[model samples]
Target: MELNQVYFWTNTIKDWKRLLQPDKYKHVILQSWQELVSRGVVCIYGFVIMPNHLHIVWEMLEPNGKEIPHASFNKFTSHTILADLKQHHPQVLPFFSVDDSDRLHRVWQRDPLAILMDGQEKVEQKIEYMHRNPLHERWNLVDSPENYRWSSAPFYETGLDEWGILTHYKDRF
Candidate 1:
């Protein structure tokens, strides 16, 4: 088996579903991300949630000297996100349901595209790329990178980390 120290992930929904068909849904997803980081389950390296998908750069930290397996974290986050979405708004029921195969609710794509990040350069580059996604030619939600609050752009711009979870990137910001 291959071993990697760091990984980049790109996970999407089935059929490119746009249940984040609106802005509030996206905000809720962002909030969930912040909550996870605050609890110390992971570090928020970078992230951008688009209308239909999201891009994130993060590190799953070991707990009490125990390594956090990537697959398990992803599954946990998937469940948490779905549960929160369902609890906050009953509107999500039309899109997702329990899967018979695994006997669990499946919402995200089966697997994510993971690229191991080994060096500082790769890490920095991925961070920049994630920030740029919200400004693609088709997307005009912001005039500048920092204007997008869904991302860590604001902290990078002002160094005023409204969310405590950004401590790891304070220097970079």
Candidate 2:
């Protein structure tokens, strides 16, 4: 989680709910990354958005104001998702309700995993793992890694970053 260091990060939804099954919610994640990258807060190398969780290969370039980039990401996405649910998906709100004093609904589980990737090999390994995740038997989301739309696999395979949110890992490591 150190600034300017690459990390393999994973964050999951509360209770492993498939709240991200919808395309709209996934876009919420993409938008957050876009904002972070555009502002130079982070440099994303790879990522995948699964049904209930997400994995990212990124480096924190700098703090976003008073908050670290990832923390700001989680907070913003959580707030946006909560607002969307309250407005249009009220029925789904109960599933995320909690007794916490700070918030009524929790979108993301606490203590996300962030492992430092100290070398090119580790970064490549994590990127490969994330790219192939959609093809795993448990999910079977796509026939091939690059076929998954919500991942950086396609960018790696074709050198195309449709969303302008990714940086080539070689540029850093």
Candidate 3:
């Protein structure tokens, strides 16, 4: 939550819907991260965009206007994805609908899991976990971690920032 401090953050879609299974939705998440990075609000060290959730090891470089960078990301991506779904997949919108008074559609669940990374060991562990997520038997998204296009494994393994939003954890250390 504080500037320059690393955290392992996990955010899941409401009802665990596989909304991010589509490439377009995944890109929306990436674009949100890129926007925050461009505005100097966050520096992503590692990330994996899963079908229904996302994991990130990042530093909060600064606040996004009055709100924290994570809050801005949640708000921006939710609104954008919700709008897209409304226009193209209105039937799917009901799955994210809420009965409470806080707006209508809720893309992400409340209180995302954020574990503060106090040392390099913990950071490395989380980075490994994130990279291997897509390779898990349940997902089987890729044979190799680096093969997953939505993860930062390629950057760590081959020293390539294909997505342009990653800040090598070694560099940060």
Candidate 4:
């Protein structure tokens, strides 16, 4: 959580719902990432947006305003996705329902996993793991990792920032 520390993070949707199967929801995630980068809160090195989860390797440049970048991302995307569900997919709203005192809807599970990328080897290993996630037997989202549009594999393979949200990890080294 310290500034400038690189982490390989994984965030799962509440109850692992497939809410992000739609491109619109994934776009919201991309927009949040772009905003954080633009605001100098984080520098994304690699990422993959799955149907129910997301994984990324990023450096926390600074806190997003008063909160950490991850908190800002969760809050923003949850609010946006909640609103979208309330309108077009009311039935889906209950999937995120929470009976706790704080709030009603919970888009993301609490306490996401973040492993410090302490060395270049660790960083490269995580980036590869993230890129190949879509090709996992359980998901099989793409025949090849590079074909998955929601991941940084294409960027790493072709040296193109199709999403315009990537900062090469080597640059920081």
- Model 3 spans with C-alpha error above 4 angstroms: none
- Mind giving the per-residue lDDT tens digits that candidate 2 earns over 1-173? 89988999999999999999999999999999999999999999999999999999999989999999999999999999999999999999999999999888899999999999999999999999999999999999999999999999999999999888998999888
lDDT of 1 by residue, 103-163 (tens): 4556677677878776778877887887887788887777778888777677767877765
Q: Identify the superior model by TM-score, candidate 1 or candidate 4.
A: 4
lDDT of 3 by residue, 32-67 (tens): 998998888899999999999999999998888999
Q: What residue pairs clash in candidate 1, if any at all?
A: none
How good is model 1 by TM-score?
0.72
Model 4: lDDT equals 0.93
Error of 2 at 139 (Å): 0.7
Which TM-score value belongs to model 3?
0.97
The lDDT of model 1 is: 0.65
Give me the runs in candidate 4 sitting further than 4 Å from their true place. none
lDDT of each: 0.65, 0.95, 0.93, 0.93
Number of the top TM-score candidate: 2
What TM-scores do the predictions have? 0.72, 0.98, 0.97, 0.98
Q: How many backbone overlaps does candidate 3 show? A: 0
Q: List the residue pairs that clash in candidate 4.
A: none
Model 3, poorest ten-residue lDDT window? 162-171
List where candidate 2 sits over 4 angstroms from the true fold.
none
Q: How far is candidate 4 from the true structure (C-alpha RMSD, Å)?
A: 0.8
**lDDT (Cα, 0-100) at 131 in candidate 1:** 80
Rate residue 15 of model 1 by lDDT: 57
